[model samples]
Target: MNNKTRQFFVAALMAASLGTVIAAQAAGAVESLRGRDVETQSREPGKYATEKDGPPIERNYVQQPPLIPHKIDGYSITTNFNKCMDCHSWTRYRETGATKVSLTHFKDRDGKELSNISPRRYFCNQCHVPQTDAKPLVENTFKKAEGLR
Candidate 1:
């Protein structure tokens, strides 16, 4: 072949080889997917933020999780759709000494009243959680009356 044709063939091969190297380099940085076993994946365990890790969103001073100190795993204290409600439900929790769900959970989204635990209350973690080991976003000396000492 003439010089021009030979040069063109060489350039094409060089481009193809360079592309292969780039693709190989990119594969290393890719996230290595773990096995399908749900038990092992981070998502299977579900992540939670502690009060300290969480941005200082103002909580209803009167309403809060009474006993839990860590993000409750998605175990339902009561038999129902996954949420923290299983123990907090009034019907079953009293025996367990778990804090009974608040009375307001009985209200429906439309403001209708129903007896027993409200279906909307099924999501227990929506409001209550345990303390977390994290840094406070900002500093404050505010304390409860007892803490003043």
Candidate 2:
């Protein structure tokens, strides 16, 4: 077809698609669960039971970062201050009985090691998450590693 004819057909097709969507929305045909059980169910309180010296959880897969085993309720981790470093830094771990931050945390994106935790790895929460005893919000079908199984 000619350029003008092809453009006209494309514009008409777009208009038809938009009109169909508008009509469906106006007719209340859009699927929504605004007042359904999933939406209206009473929410449980946010309290979490923390385990400080509990048995270590097995990693689900290889290279899975270990979950935090203790509560970090009042810890501050701003650009200027990382409370986790007080216990987990290399200099303090030996005395504080806390695990040392991984050597990888000291390396930058280029793999050059620094005297301190790399900027990229300074945020402990990015990889380490505290464990909670709360029930799963949804059913999970995850399987553990072969050795764990």
Candidate 3:
């Protein structure tokens, strides 16, 4: 084989063993898994929130942690998320007792206060989400800051 090709192969082996790679080489797909990207290159990060019942009577104070009682699998979470604001928006929240969304939702594109859900705050899943099925993966000791306050 050519000396340059042989040199490159030897360099790649050394880099792999070292666990560090340049940006260009790292961006390249791994040779072992060229076509399949099941667990290697899946989209999105962060786990879904958990669903639970209301807090105890003694602890059942104001602004209770919202209960996510419904399943939320494969639900479209795009930039313009209509699936969420349909119910939780200020206009419809009162009709269902679903809690009025933030006042910021009342503003329009020009920042003028409108009487409806603003396009900016329409994506409810960005801050809130309903829980789905269980899949035991890793454990978490992290807690919410609100619980401390």
Query: Which candidate leads the pack in TM-score?
Result: 2
Q: Residue by residue across 1-149, what tens digits does model 3's lDDT show?
A: 99999999999999887675565468774443223332233222423233343332222334444445554445675765576566666568888666566776678878899876666666666555454223445786645456544
Model 1 lDDT per residue over 1-149, tens place? 99999999999999999998788778864333332332332333223234322333434344444445434544665554655445556666887566566767778888787785566666555655555433444686755454323
Candidate 1, residue 142: how far the Cα is off, in Å: 5.7
In model 3, which range of ten residues has the least summed lDDT? 33-42
Assess candidate 3 and give its TM-score to the true structure.
0.40
Q: Estimate, for each residue in 1-149, the C-alpha lDDT of model 2 and write its tens digit.
A: 89999999999999999999999999977754322222223344433355555655667987788888776767899999999999998889999888889998899899998998999989899998876555665799988778766
Give candidate 3 regions above 4 Å deviation: 1-49, 52-70, 108-116, 129-149
Winning model by lDDT: 2
Q: Show where candidate 2 strays beyond 4 Å.
A: 1-48, 52-55, 147-149
Model 1: residue 82 alpha-carbon error in angstroms: 3.8
Stretches of model 1 off by over 4 angstroms after superposition = 1-60, 63-67, 74-80, 141-149
